[model samples]
Target chain A: MSAAGAGPGSREGHREPRRAVDGALRADTADTADTADTADTADNPGLAARVTTRRGGFTLDVAVEVAHGEVVAVLGPNGSGKSTLLGTLAGLFDPESATVTLADRVLTDTDAGITVPVHRRRVGLLSQQALLFPHLTAHENVAFGPRCAGQGRRAAGAVADRWLAEMGVAELADRRPSELSGGQAQRVAIARALAVEPDLLLLDEPFAALDVDAAPAVRAVLRRVVRDSVVGGQTVLLVTHDVLDAVVLADRLVVLADGEVVEQGPTAEVLARPRSGFAARIAGLDLVTGTACAGGLHTLDGTLVSGAASEPLDHGDPAVAVFAPRSVAVHRERPAGSPRNVVPVRLAAMEPQGEVVRLRAGASGRGPAWGEGLAADVTPAAVAELGVEPGDELWFAVKATEVAVHPSGR
Target chain B: MTRAAPSSPRTRSSRTGSTGHTLPWPVWVPAVVGFGLIAVPVAGLVLRADWPNFLTLITSDAALDALRLSLQTGLTSTALCLLFGTPLALVLARSDLPGLPVWRSIVLLPLVLPPVVGGLTLLFLLGRTGPVGQLLDAWFGVTVPFSTVAVVIAQTFVAMPFLVVSLEGALRTAGDRYEAVAATLGASPMTALRRVTIPVVLPGLVSGAVLAFARALGEFGATVAFAGSLQGTTRTLPLLIYLDSQDDLDSAVALSLLLVVVAVVVIVATRTRDASGVR
Candidate 1:
């Protein structure tokens, strides 16, 4: 994704790009280095599950695959069957007709009626709520899985101690859930999940409920854990609503809308060329639907906006042009440059975006009027030099190469 | 943090004085009557208790026999309630068995039924010449009436509802959240029940047991109706108090005070137990 305008805390605001790069690097290493030895298919090391479940009025039908050591993000809007997919993989619900194979081990085969129980599935699900056993101390909570798997008390305690240290919550071992902070509880939950040595780990918005100040620390721990597990053959599936989460942790993106997989590709590739409004919105890009022509597109606003497409499009084909706010140049007057397209618009609002300023320009020089608009992210210094304000008339320019045009889907 | 909503300063200042403004008589008067109705009788019972010779009267052979029998039967009755009531509570609270509402109503029958009526129902099932009782007598040579075991059974008949209802409410409130999580953590259903579910609802179970024991200790009508009053066998503390009222007023008051003290102890012990285990 195009980087978000760096906020006042510029380093933290730019966390997504830096993390996505690291994840991509690790993913590339894992893919090329170890594509052998599954005792079945040396080429395929990923776990695949084709889930189809009907609950209430929503029918969830999606196929998900995560390569060994690869982290895939199941990003979706609310009520998009994210939980249903995770629950079915974790063996909480039996899918109608599906096959779930994790590292060559079939966990669920509906046609064969071979559905392993939750405890036997060897799938670890850490939810938004920590769901720690309240009566158990952090250490005991971590030890529960090993103990249930027939370990002695001392052996289980040792296993718990090791994971607790690994999770960076070693000091919180004796503390109860109520005595622990939200982030601390979540870390312990992560340790608990790992102690089970699950083949497929489902992290369901583990940071969603955490405090803003604590999310970074938890995110760091999670990244380290996922990075370290590359050699251990553990596949991770992260379910999140936040694009930053997907951008930072997942190497691949699987976008779900209304219980269907709308898009799936490499994280950066899919993010840079979103086909849906939800995807574009999360990526923080302005999505303009236009009629594709030879060179660029003709927008519905009765204007010509020139942009490049990754692939050539046939004339009159419905397409979308996605561009970042930072790509737009805000000016007091029309400037002569190499810019391919320029639109005259009135400033609807100017919002402070960290070190940068984002100007919302619309057709009317009034507060948030109804019309086609462009979101322009410019430097605070530039805004001050131009003295931009609400209801100001201005012209914004964007190079054709900055906008990526792609075929729009129903 | 509450958002500071804009409001008139005068209105806020007036609201500060509203707490000082007494409640309307209609509301206050009925509330006082509700409190007084329950408090007045217990207060009178305490005030009328025989202070002098209370210890001496309770220590007498007849009173001692009844007190010992009541304690023994009450303990056994509460033990039985816990043994049976726990599973019943689990089934009622956790399962989705058909006819659940009807079964729940049937289970609550003893709670509202008169003690004498409950005793009669038990008699129909277990009394001599009764179907089950006849089978027991012919096969095992067991006669229930006028026996200490009968006293325990009668007390259980009258008091088991209190235990079951309390436990069911506890189990329902606790829910199966811990159990579900524990299963996902690799604990089998039975192991989860013992390790997670039981510990989570321990306070409820304790309170229920205490209430059942208290009810059993004071039971009189059911014991008299079903078990029959035989001194040192079925004559519990309440029966002793009823018997003493005819000849020894002082002993009757002393026995009543003892029952009240024991019930208070049970309540306080359970309260402390709950306070100590705050799950």
Candidate 2:
């Protein structure tokens, strides 16, 4: 295969043009970044790859790039091919049509008729379960990777001790996997993966099995290891169902739904403006797509609303409106206020959502002429003061600026 | 809260008694019969044995030779079984080879085959004029039938399935997660098998070996049929008992008691080994 001379700057600048060839390759940007970053350090800039899969009636095609000191998260729903994508990237499964390039070497290229065996791929994979050798002590588990790489027994043990110390689990070195707690075991597993100094690291729900209380600590430890350049410009691909984790730790989020990239961009951008209902659900936001008009934004079914109008809307121009329930202010009466959009509504119900309370209400007969309910998020203090209850009449005021508008179409 | 009747506690106690009733005589009758069926044979062995002559019988030259040969052949057979069965079990349990189910059946064939028939099959395969036997004779001048080595081979053929089946089940249940983890750590398949797979399944292997050894020690029909009975050569204790029973019932009974003692010793040794292994 001929090597492409496109530099990182060119790749980033022409992302849109390259995306036109295949949307899957566009998703490959995250993996490419990883490869480029590692390549910059090792005199080889092709250490990242993307894999697409067609399996069991679902197609999972994603492009990812990882740079050294970068943590790329593959975020999606259950059965969204997150695990399969990770597996394929790690050479556990061969994609029907995909290209896997690492630095100057092509690990797999269906078009070029190249496929490397998994064991020789030098990719370290950490599954949800730590999967430590039960019979081996923590030190032995960490040493296993180095020993397998052909280090002498004494040398391997020394190296393992160093890693264990770095991981802050040196005291547990002699304890077997069964003896270690979930957090400790994961630390050892991370150490084991890093011991081999793999070019790429694959983590499949590494924190899924951890308790909620233990997850943050483990996540922090993992972030330190993967993000540290001392670990040799490691590129990490983390697959997770937790959006919070992706938002907190990932440099970019690639959302997969039913085997397709429903949304992929910077973590904050995707979270802020999810294009599909699937992405909205993942981002914990309500997404409503409609046509903008001079009077207000019209629902797809032609229901008109007197809400704050964004820029002068051309009739039938596609637009997306996204707002959090907390942004909608609920009122018991139509009080005079500076806010422009205020619609009388009847309280549908109230549900407690963690620290916030969700109030479901419908706009007075003038709202969308179909199944439509507006959700308002408020604090317990606000709910108490407003005496919000099902069947109570209220008014919802939404600021036009709070209602973000994005043009439709790719 | 209600005022209790005088009979309340009595009634409650009686109800509990009824609920806790034991099995009736009908159940015990068959259970007792089954126990007697197993116990009667053991009683007969004790009743017929010549207790006083047991020491003398065991000390006889022929008896001593047979005992020694039985120990040597049984141990040798067990070693051979382990040598070949472990790898076979690993492959059967771990590999995705074609027709594995059929191969599994073939590995287990000896268990269902009559011991004598199994011995005959081995004899046919290794006999002087047998296909592989002729080549072995031509190339190495080794004649297998009616020899001590033949005894070990016959015993191994019958006893190997015990080890392989047990070990295979252990391997399958153990799963490949550890091995996968080892591979990711940079260990090759062989190293993973050695450090992760073998250590994890060591208990199964050890127990399987013990069971195979016990089975080989008690093996009679296959050993006698394939290797033949030759005093001081191929005559194991089982064969000696068969030979003496024809005219010397007392000596035969004494040999029977000696065999029982040896079996008990082996069982105790195995149990001790198993305990240590687990520890």
Candidate 3:
């Protein structure tokens, strides 16, 4: 509903964007400065947008403000309306209600009865398939945008060459799209989207079709090209199902489920403490499902798991109680506590991960969660100190507030 | 369990007629007879042609007039098919306009109609005394039937379905994905249509036009009945051939051979280009 903290989360814990890729280009501060010298980014400062669209029975209501040069990755499951959001912004569909503006230009404001046509919207969209015009060469494919913007063939061809060079696919320019490898075609498609100097960019699962070997190369290109230092940080909305795409390239993360923004924050923040099931699964956390009762959650079979709400839910409404595995504290005995949420469980498995051991526990020594249930990330030191191993009985305890309850993502 | 020898080129050659029998005698018997039924009539025409006098027969004044008329009318009809029939096919492929199937069937009617039947329908619709034709006669004082224009109209009526059907299939195969992508790249609808949609379906359009041209060239009953058979005006090659059949049987056979050659050439040329498909 509002735009707050729209800039990307701090770029930390990421692979160096400037790792010597192909031994030719390095995405470093100098590269950014060099790009700033060549391109005029000040003319297109990123703008905030509020998008609301309803298709058939599905309605997606989301507001996102992409800071100048920030990449916002919209992470969601299939049929969760990620593509719908991008399509609405790109002027493919006139939303039921939306007010989308990039910089001073009003692309779509349904209330004002002003909806720019797609070609005039200045929002370049790339989908999972590169969809290169088969009849066009890679050079001509990249030139298409500039050509459509009224550049002559020679000038547009020059622009295409420049972009192809920047993307490290210049040598393949003359080859038709059918002659291009999947990765090469995707790179050209990306270059084509940027050639027109659009104010906003929308990528719909851009890497989903690429093999694992080709994805990282394109990801590197996005990191180097889409950053504020290089391309003047035009606002980009990347719709992806892969967490790695969010972690590597996105500054902010907006997790959608069933056409609603279930959780959103800095890429690291939401990932650190996912509040929804889809988010939690992608973030690698344990999420317990239940219905909200007077005091806490009532599991499917009426087992009570007490937890505080990150956002309040009406009693009897569906809810999912979620917490990071690291949040659970495993104990050897039933620890005495004052109204703390605690459960007796059998330690199903213990696997060492870095400095910590991943512990899988069930509801109790006898229950459906007997073999695999709650997961807790404890230090390898703790595993040694507590002498915990597979099939060991233990008690798991957590502060009710640490486990966040929210409306079900379904 | 007993097993037959593994299939190799050597073994397959032995199994087939090239070496010995592979299929049963009954299968080849009916199939070859069926093939000969079509082959014999075509062979008869080819064999009956007076090769030495073929050029002289075709170059005769009446034959030349008819040949010229056929070419002119065929070209005009094909042009009309491209101009109007392509848009019709686009509408059929892309739109949900009411009565769509009815319109499609109407376009398809001439394809299945007996040439004489098509000619009769056109004669009724455009005859000087008919309802619509009467209005045109009153307003412009232009009669439609039994004229050069009428010949083209008759040819187009029979040929247009070929063009529209081919184009609709092409448009459907090309789909809207490329056009949608083009729009996102800042292409206006018209630009996308011209630059993306048209080029993508060009092969289909070409084949359709070629087929229409061939159909128009061969049109006889419709052109003769609706447009009349007048030398240098409405009479076309097919009409000339039919009229010649009553007396000059040798010339008619030669002309028939030429028509068969032209049709085969047209089909082969277009099909080969499609098989090669734009690389």
Question: What is the DockQ for all candidates, taken in turn?
Answer: 0.21, 0.20, 0.26
**What is candidate 3's lDDT per residue for B31-116, written digit by digit as tens?**
99999999999998878889899899877898778777887889999999999999999999988799999999988999888999
Candidate 2 lDDT tens digits, A1-410? 10121212223422233333344444534333432333343454434555666878787766665544456678887888887877776766778877777655678898888887667778899887888876678898898888888899999999999889878899999986756777888888888888888878888888888778777677766765665555854667778887656644566566777887666665545665455667655666433456767655666767553344433445776554556677788888785867655667788777787898877665457554222366678999998998778988788877765765433321
Candidate 2 per-residue C-alpha lDDT over B1-279 given as tens digits, one digit per residue, 9 for 90 to 100: 011111123443553467666898899999999999987887798998888777898899999999999899889988998899999999999899999999999999989999999888878889999888888899999999899988999989999999999899888877777777776666778888888888878878887887888889888988888899999889999899999999998888888888888888887877776645432
Docking class of 3: acceptable
- What are the clashing pairs of model 1? A7-A354, A8-A354
Q: After superposition, how far is residue A266 of candidate 2 from its true place, in Å?
A: 1.9
Fnat, model by model in order, equals 0.36, 0.45, 0.38
The parts of candidate 2 lying over 4 Å away from their true place are A1-47, A229-233, A285-410, B1-49, B137-140, B264-279
Q: Model 3, range A1-410, lDDT digits (tens) per residue?
A: 01223212311101122222123322222132222211222344454566677765677777665645667888988878777788788887767887877777888898999888988888888888788887678898889888998999999999999999989999998887656777888898899889888888888888988888989778767666876365756577889987667765675688887777777655644664454657867767555666887666777777777778644567876666666788888888778875366777887666566677878774464543312467789988788899887878888777777776654421
TM-score for each candidate, following the candidate numbering: 0.74, 0.73, 0.73
Q: A1-410, model 1: which lDDT tens digit per residue?
A: 11211111221212133333234233322332232233322344556777777866787778776666667888898899888888788887667877888777898999999988888877888888787876688999999999999999999999999999998989989887766777888899889988888878899998998888888678767766775552254568899997656655676678887777776655644564455656755667655656787777767555666788645567776656667889989878887989987777788777686777878766754322212356788998898899988888888788899977654420
Please write out the lDDT profile of model 1 over residues B1-279, one tens digit for every residue.
011111113333453466576777899888999999978877887788788777898899988899899999999999999998899889999998999989988888888898888778778888888999999999999988778988899888878888888888877776676676777788888889888888777777888888899899989888888888888988899998998899988788888888888888888877876766553
Regions more than 4 Å wrong, model 3: A1-47, A285-410, B1-40, B272-279
DockQ top scorer: 3
Which has the better TM-score: candidate 1, or candidate 2? Answer: 1
RMSD of 3: 14.4
Q: Rate the local accuracy (lDDT) of all candidates.
A: 0.75, 0.72, 0.75
